[model samples]
Target: MPRLSGCAFFSDKIMQAKVDLLHTGAEAMFADLGHFSKKAIQIAFLSSIYPSLVLTYAGQTAYLINNVNDFSDGFYKFIPRPVYWPMFVIATLAAIVASQSLISATFSVIKQSVVLDYFPRVKVVHTSHQKEGEVYSPEINYILMVLCVGVILGFGGGKEIGNAFGVVVIMVMLITTIMLTLVMIIIWRTPPVFVGMFFIPFVIMEGSYVSAVFTKIPEGGWLPFAVSMILALIMFVWYYGRQRKIEYEMANKITMERLGQLLAMPEVQRVPGLCFFYSNIQDGLTPILGHYIKNMSSLHTVTIFVTLRYLLVSKVDQRERVLIKRLGPRGVYQCTVQYGYADNLSLKGGDDLVAQVMRCLKRHIAMSTDRRSSVSTEEEIANLEAASLAGVVHVRGKMRFYVGDDAGCFDKVMLRSYEFLHSICRSALPALGMPLQQRVEIGMLYKV
Candidate 1:
């Protein structure tokens, strides 16, 4: 079971030594030891094959002889040359094979970690992997298959396809460098002084080299530009749509105050007490977590609560801000931290944020003035009652018993505040399937 944030110090003391032992043992057995030697050997074998073929085909024997002949005949007297343009072609093939192997291996490691939730997901696998830990990729394999077939079909007929591959790849690298620099400024929050010192100079140098390469080889530019444009369009549509959906979800959730109140409940206090719960407010509170918390019957000393803000915006400034407060036993201090990003951000490796929160809970409570509006207090209750003379039940705050299917305690708590939700839906819609003002009507229920 996950330990509560407050008492985790004790748990950590007891478990740290064991955890260290396991980590050291795993490294020795799996990372440093010869357990993965077989895989390495396979990688080496594949890397070596094409390079050997390319070298051999290039007439290494004749090339050496020609060099010697040139030196002996006083350079200018060297007239005859053995044809080996085929070697250039072979070398290109060899380079492509080598690049693919390396790319596949890197992505394979990434893919395993991502699917298992050991790390944040990225576009590591363009295709499939056969085994859980295998480095082979189906995407790479298919791409290779297509290239090989193309090579066979266009053999000696169209070298442009082969030539285009290298040129386009270089163009991609240049574009990537530009994108990386921009990302560092926007996402990394790197200081402008350092960014200018490093970024401006590096861009100047790299951009010049990239421009020179493209100018020297114009065909490379057009093809890569076309492909890049297509990819940019796809990404824009995908990311923009996703951001809108996430925003819609967060806006409809309970206020930050109620969330903090929920964390203070007796049932919520038993589990390794989480101070804050960050989710895509639309996901609301997870029913499973709520059920476990409600069932836990222990008391914990320290806690910090959170509700994460995951938003994808074109600009980072559009991100949400955090709200923090101290609730003080049975209702100690609590905080909410919010952040925005233009892309998906991972929580791993971000340090012990909850620990920092625990300290804030003990000493301070910094939240927005707007928080009171979101949370329902005694005044809100009277207003709610006045608005509902149709005998609508008005439940508010920690004392309220949320009514919903035991969808789990967390979700139930969230749904309870939405009591007017179902009524509103019934009054607004004529039929379940019928259109509702150009809107896609979801159920009043919020499921995590």
Candidate 2:
């Protein structure tokens, strides 16, 4: 009776382990969605991969049933001896391809998060000129390689590694299902009954898998949980710190009245050349502008406040990419360069940005209907041409954020972590293709 009970318990464990391993293959099927179209992936999986997987699993089960002693390493044991070497080579190649796919997917996810301000800025290299989504981040790739090595060394075997992988796979599936349900209800306006119908079965199945995996926590499942929590905390700190910095800039923005007063100061000199002041806010002058005026007491001949805005769409029309608006002061304009998530920043530093801005300025001046304004088309055009002849200077603010003296320890630690990340991550200006000689950075401190 005791032997029978022990056998039953082992059978149950084997079944659950198989369930955990099977889901990983399903997850891998969609991992390279960034590299291929959804329709192509779905069609391939449904027609070829799914049937192949089903047959392979069925054959393995049959072999195991017939040769119970070969249950250990059944995958290899079931293979015919004559073709074992070929099968092993094919499996090794497949594993490499899968790893590459997952790496590409990781880069795509990180790029999207950076665009949406959920992650710190990193150097992203577009692997394909035609496909914007095909990206490779060296920093992330190195980190992943290190972590993979460490995990392999620490776990020392497939069983413990499988425990960790199973937990992560189940959790990801559960989260994805919940997100899909929310999208169906909120975005697609699907009926509640339909949403529930689509969600409940998956949740129940995944919940069972989750329970099975939780039992492996002491073995190796805790690794994924720890790593995920650390990453989530870093992302949270970055998002929180970014929001606070934007709020501080908006609150301390220079008003039109104050700008006018500063411009009217006799000590202030209007220097020749086109100066582009980078700003976060679209409407008013950034605090960096105010700081520049207070220190140098000089303004550019043609000052353009440039703001880059990224939209959620895949691409924006080239005709509607740049929006130029005349601000209160003469020779001062605001140019908003809009880009979609999939659009490339093709405007290089020297003549490209200048030409685009000039074209946009000319269009804006010609389209203006305001009669009270002092914009003379010919004179403004001449001044801009002369400024272009002189040179273009890009002014960017180097900002540092710190917590207040009265802040709690959590705030201090979070802000400090954000600062450290910001220090190490790639700067926004360098990515713009701006030349170091022409770029000017004004240091500023903010108590967020």
Q: lDDT: which candidate is best?
A: 2
lDDT tens readout by residue for model 1, 1-448:
4457535633443233222211111111222112246676566547864455455535444555757655333222332345345545665786565555444554565455434433322433222122333344454466557856765575443334433454454454456567877887999987888777866766664454444444424432344455557545544433443343344456544444555565667655433223233232333432323333444433233333345443322223312333455342333234444433222223223333433443343233232233334433444333323322322111111111234465666444434433322222222111112223322211222333
Q: What's model 1's lDDT at 121?
A: 28
Q: Candidate 2, residue 105: CA error in Å?
A: 1.7
Q: Clashing residue pairs in candidate 2, if any?
A: none
| lDDT agreement with native, every candidate | 0.40, 0.83
Over 174-259, each residue of candidate 2 has an lDDT whose tens digit, in order, gives 89999999999889999999999999999987777777788889999899999989889989999988888888888999988889
Instruction: Flag regions of model 1 displaced more than 4 Å.
Output: 1-99, 102-158, 172-209, 215-221, 254-448
lDDT of 1: 0.40
CA error at residue 73 for candidate 1, angstroms:
23
Q: State the displacement of the C-alpha of residue 125, model 1, in Å, after optimal TM-score superposition.
A: 8.0
